[model samples]
Target: MIREEVKIISKEYLNKDVLKIRFEKPKEFQYKPGQFINIKFEQEGSFRMRAYSILNTPSEETLDICLKIIPNGLASESFKEAKENDKYTIIGPFGYFQLNENEKEHVFISTGTGVVPFINIIKEFVKKDYKMTLIAGYKKQENIICHEELKKIEQENKNFVYKPTITREEWGGLKGRVQKHLPENLSKKMFYICGLKEFVIETKESLLEKGVNEKYIKVERYN
Candidate 1:
């Protein structure tokens, strides 16, 4: 629980609604991959704090986060006006969503910006001798975030495979929800899931029904 005000070094939109913001890393800040930090800001003239998952490995030079701007949400409204050099208080590198070391193969499943933590986790273990697969779901191609960067990582890393599924739109690749497109070797790999309640609950139930041990499946629910 260290809290410090940090300067935003850069901020840009990865897509129409996703904001990629980078902060000058505080010398005292320490965190593991897949963790999130709370940003303290003003909402309705009062102070409000919200948790955002880190998108880059902690070892990286800067602390980066991708914000999915929900329309009219308190935190979303504050971030919409955010600019470079803005300073905001950040607290903790919280959550226990780090990579599972016991499994040689790891599967990351998510919808929308739920993929944020996986981005950080993957960056940390990308160099290790482990197989990683990402199943990311979105409403349409236009809604896909970090699509090209994940693809490039897949192309360059023999251990990684990126699968993007689109629902409510025409797509030549995987379609429908993430639960429908899970891998075959379910019992062997560690599964990580993040998303809204319905998606996370359904995906967890689906995995349990498929004989994956409940202990091997970890989930973080968000909206």
Candidate 2:
């Protein structure tokens, strides 16, 4: 693992609160699709850090991270004050989430910015023969991130399916929490669930109750 200070390339807002920040990749940095980097920042009179999943594909030249800014959060303050050309100290590309090696369809369930890791993984999986399904939940239709890009990927790739659901607002696509309307044949496919603790726990429990094997499900909590 390498601790390096990298310069911010650019910053963009995916919606009203989500930030998609990119940094110039270090020359020797290497990590898998489902990994994250620990970002170091100065908070108050001391240093603090936050873990943000790598958002871009592994083959990309730059590292990207998408996160929702919780108002007055520790990392949120640093993210809010960040600008292009600012230097960010990053350490490690750490995570244990792995795609199942066996022949099974890939199912991803996530809410808000928890979809970050899957976004990175899907970019790698789409090139393979795996049949992938992504169900992303948001509070409203407008809060959806990577909307056009994911839709384009869905249209172009026959092996991939994208569903963007909403809870607090009416939408043309799917509606409700991720666990409320899960895809069919849950037992046969491998599951990856991410989001707040409740979201992860509820979805995992739902899958377990449906007879999906414990080994077939992987989960990550954002909050």
Candidate 3:
């Protein structure tokens, strides 16, 4: 890991609670698509930090982080008020939640803001011949994030499929949690899951019960 102070290039709200921040990439800094960075700042004379997954592919010139704001959250509150040119110390290129380059058939499951890393992975690695299925879960239609971009990817790449489901509100698309929308067959496919702890646990268990080898499943959990 390396420590560097970077300037925020811009900030925008992607949804009601999700903020997308772009930072100036430091010279000589490099990171894989699915990694994350820890942003550190000072509050009340004490240092505070939070880790957010990198949302931009390595081919992008800048670094992007998608943050889900929470009520009274220290880091979230601070980031909500952050402005362009603001400088913060970041340390990382952390986490092993990356893609297997050789895998042709891949399945990704994410809930809410947990979809960040998958966005990076797909944009960076998905190719014309690669078959990828993305199953995203949200509480309501308004809670869905990055749907437009995912849809564009699906439209442009015939091999890619996007499935978004809502749990609390009715929609024309599928309803219920992502686990319920998972594909029935798991053979010869790799699965990547990210979401709340319970969602990850339940999905992993369901996959295991369906005879998916643990080796073919990769998971990252959020609180």
TM-score of each: 0.97, 0.97, 0.96
- Give the local distance difference test score of model 3: 0.89
Winner on TM-score between 1 and 3 is 1
Candidate 2 whole-model C-alpha lDDT, 0 to 1: 0.89
Off by over 4 Å in 3: none
**TM-score (C-alpha, index-matched) for candidate 1:** 0.97
lDDT of each candidate versus the true structure: 0.90, 0.89, 0.89
lDDT of 1 by residue, 1-223 (tens): 5799999999889999999999988997889988899999988889999999989887789999998999999989888998889899999989998888878999999999999999878778888998999999999998898888898899889999999999989978899988778997787899999988999999999999899999999998885
Which prediction has the highest lDDT against the true structure? 1
The count of residue-pair clashes in candidate 2 stands at: 0
lDDT of each residue in 1-223, candidate 3, tens digit only: 7899999999989889999999998877789878888899876679998889999988788989998999888888889889999999999989999988778889999998889999998888767467889999999999888889999999988888899999998889999988788777779999999988998999999999989999999998877
Candidate 2 or 1, higher lDDT: 1
